[model samples]
Target: MSDTTPRIETERLVLRVPRIEDFERYAELLADEEACRFIGGHMPRPAAWRRFLQMPGAWAVQGFAMFSVIEKSSGLWLGQLGPWQPDGWPGTEVGWALHRDAWGKGYAYEGAAAAIDWAFAHLGWTEVIHCIDADNAASQALARRLGSRVLRQSGMPAPYEHVVVDVWGQSREDWQVRRSTRA
Candidate 1:
């Protein structure tokens, strides 16, 4: 709740920095096979622990990273989504992943839209991309819902270079126009 810490509130969600208490549900999400199918395969708790720290580390060092998506009503960690750009990454990416129980709720779309807005305004990003697997219809549809289109087909950086991805995105100018129309 510090003046410096970034926190975003939507109609039913809270996007905030990763806290130690969120690791349990974060581990659960990472270990869910179906929920994580396209993002990355399931991992054991030990491995999940390693991956779980990345978000907080990113926020501290880079001053930005995927946010912990929280269900405001229930105080639950829904998932992670927001600004991300790792070494050798394809582009400035706004990615998301939610637990299976949270599906069909439009939380991803809701959270992602807000994230995109924040990245452009706060992060000063000219463009944002969502690296989606070709078969990942869910993410693809979500990207479309956010008004992103497939800009190119590209391979990721080391470790993930093998995974084929369709980079979907829209420029900040497009986002501003889109937002104006909605208003």
Candidate 2:
């Protein structure tokens, strides 16, 4: 993790901004057909390279973006999750995509919880959404686990205009209530 980048540590994961060292694994994750299925489909190296750059660009330009989720024990790149608000987005979002190897380990939920807190506390976001594909029941379950319900159905922009997604979210007030209850 870069000292300059913002980071959040959970019990078993480290969420931090995308660094140059992360590209290989990021590209690998993007290339896995099963893993990338719901996340705009698996791409070749060239396309993966372009897609991989988006996170760092978002961090550098927008001052916030998905963090590279690292396993605390293995120090491995497990996934990405955090604040994301691109042009034509459905809403302020805390999105996630994990390497298949990391699935079922609860990393996405763990990282996203921290990301949501960071977005609400540091970014001053009023609400946060997850643009989940209809067929992705795993993500749907994760969204529910995060205390977000389906706020609406929405279409994407430009290259993804043909794809529609469920906007799952909760307000800052709702999240605070959930957090307090969990405590």
Candidate 3:
């Protein structure tokens, strides 16, 4: 991870830049069909390796990318979530994909909230989006909890172009207002 990479800590999770050591657990998350269904679905080990490397590469090229979500109590890798905007993306986004075991917990929202804060405060991002599949009620709920609503409908880039998603988001000012209300 870069020296400049910021590590964010929530009540029960730690979010840091993706490291090589995270590949094994990260691969496991990608390998689980049900866990990945709303995302890109499951992939073979070799394909998982490539997907694993994308986060670090994105940080190197874009100066920002998803953080590897770690459970603080168990010190285990849970998943990855944070700022992500590759070429031809609809807009700057804060995404989440957790391990099946991490499901039903509040880690996704906890980690993503910190990430969205970082993006708006440090990355100069005016808004943050969550490209959720129409069928992904869980993610939609998470977005709602974060005070986001479907701004529009769009398709992902190549390889996922056929997958239509609801672009849920809110501007930095809106996020701040919500955060304050929560406090």
The candidate with the higher lDDT, 1 or 2, is 2
Spell out the clash pairs found in candidate 2. Answer: none
- The segments of candidate 2 whose C-alpha lies over 4 angstroms from its true place after superposition are none
Q: Rate the local accuracy (lDDT) of all candidates.
A: 0.92, 0.93, 0.92
C-alpha TM-scores of all predictions = 0.97, 0.97, 0.97
Error of 3 at 29 (Å): 0.8
Q: Per-residue error at 180 for model 2, in Å? A: 0.8
Task: State, as a TM-score between 0 and 1, how close model 2 is to the true structure.
Answer: 0.97
Query: Per-residue CA lDDT of candidate 1, range 61-108, in tens?
Result: 889999999999999988999999988899999999898889989999
Candidate 3 lDDT by residue in tens digits, 67-88: 9999999989999999999998
lDDT of model 2 at position 87: 99
- Most lDDT-accurate candidate: 2
Q: Quickly count the clashes in candidate 3.
A: 0
Better of 2 and 3 by lDDT: 2
